[model samples]
Target: MRTTLSRRSLIAAGASLLAAPALAQSGYPNRQIRIIVAFAPGGATDILGRIVADHLSKAWNTQVIVDNKTGAGGNLGSDLVAKAPPDGYTLLLGTVGSAVTNQFLYKNMPFDSATAFTNVALVGEVANVLAVHPSVPAKTVQEYVALAKSKPGQINYGSPAIGGTGHLAMEYLQSLTGMKVEHIVYRGSSLVLQDLLAGNIPSTMDNLPAYIPHINTGKLRALGVSSAKRWFAMPDVPTIAEQGVPGYDAAPWWYVSGPAGLPPDITKKLSDEIVKGVSSPEVDKRIKDAGCAP
Candidate 1:
């Protein structure tokens, strides 16, 4: 996912943080820090939130908590942060929808996703894979498209939310492949994945974190990843662009942020810590194993 933090800026931020003076003479983060995750547990954003919280906890020598605040197409939790004090103790690990595309979808948006918070760091992104239950006979994306064409609108797929990247990715697939499939929206990835695993839904598209283990266990078959290139964790699976749809890429990115009035130094401190943590080799491997990019 693209962001204001370019590669060079990220590298410089990390180096600057390490040598910078200890956060505030009063000792910032004297108490626990809370990272608000706008979805239920087990989604990509939740998993990444936990990872970041763990790192920040260790780095600042304070307890960092992941508070799951799910509701209103992700507006509830996000609004909580938007209204929270800008002392930097309360952070938000908002996804692409909450931080970027949500403003265009919801009629009564609580806050301007673009301006309500201070964009701190790029927390990394994960590919969304088009997956089907094992019962589906189609193995590749082309085969799946052919099958869908045969059945047309009868075939249904699950998405995390109505205007989420997963839903839009599948919609984009429909336009590219010329297949008309039904879409069912869910509040979160866990439930959608649960139904898919139970064979209640024939197919679905979700972030790589929630679906990779099932795919690895052969419970779900990955038709194609939505990234431009095959993800590192699933190197054997071809991307949709490679399969047939050229230039098809819609991976959802995550970013860390605080309320709109957060101090610049506080934002930089958080961003620096996150960049350093994400750049570490051990954390990189862990992120890959979680089916994400760091």
Candidate 2:
């Protein structure tokens, strides 16, 4: 038989558990918070992650650090967060690549979005632009399809990686048009952009923000955007679906999430703070300037 604890010991233990909720509800984040970015530094995701971190640090009066864990197309970093403690101290600035598309691409993932974490809030949406080098000889989506059909497998497109949304979006486009195009994977979007500008790769589907300035300067040609509705920043361009590929829409989105089993009070506190931070006018303008819809 187990010995019974003294009344004072039992009372202290019970009080601690009872105080947990109260302490958590007092606007959590009383300590340092780590926001993991599942990508390398200097990319759009990293840049935006830093922006959010700065805002959160200022608003919460606590240290908000960004830790980049880039590998396996953002899987390594994501899995890290998925297994972290369910406390509010650790958070993930997850991307569409890590959250939604990876589920369809990977055979065995370490975590499931629905069960591994709680969605804090949506940060922003990055539209994919269908762009090609000037030598592709296709000015419109229909013309591009005709050209690809006529010379099946002759046209090649590049993406950040095989399982990235850029790759899947192009694959979806190919399925819709019944056209064949070789897929080329690059280290990152910057490398892809470098090759596209140099006429090494004929075409690619990438975040519009990366290529928007080039498109504006006539360095690259934008055939269409991936959003169903026209982008507010680039209203003149039509969406890929509206142009011809029906039901075609894809964009990389960013959101905050914490590991499963997080206390409701902590989860709610984080969600409210993140949503408020992303909704601020300054952050909204920065996101819009990046050619993403926040």
lDDT leader: 1
Q: What would the per-residue lDDT of candidate 2 be over residues 1-294, giving only the tens digit for each residue? A: 011211223323333343344544575677899999887565567767887888889988999999988777778888888999988888888787666777777888888866887656667777788999998899989988899999999989988777876888888888888999999988778888999999999999877778888899999999998887888888898899887788887866777777978776676666556667777898888878878777
lDDT of 1 by residue, 103-128 (tens): 87888999997688876777778899
Off by over 4 Å in 1: 1-26
- Model 1: clashing residue pairs? none
Worst 10 residues of 1 by lDDT: 2-11
Compute the lDDT of residue 63 as modeled in candidate 2: 98
Per-model TM-score, in order, reads 0.92, 0.87
lDDT of 2: 0.78
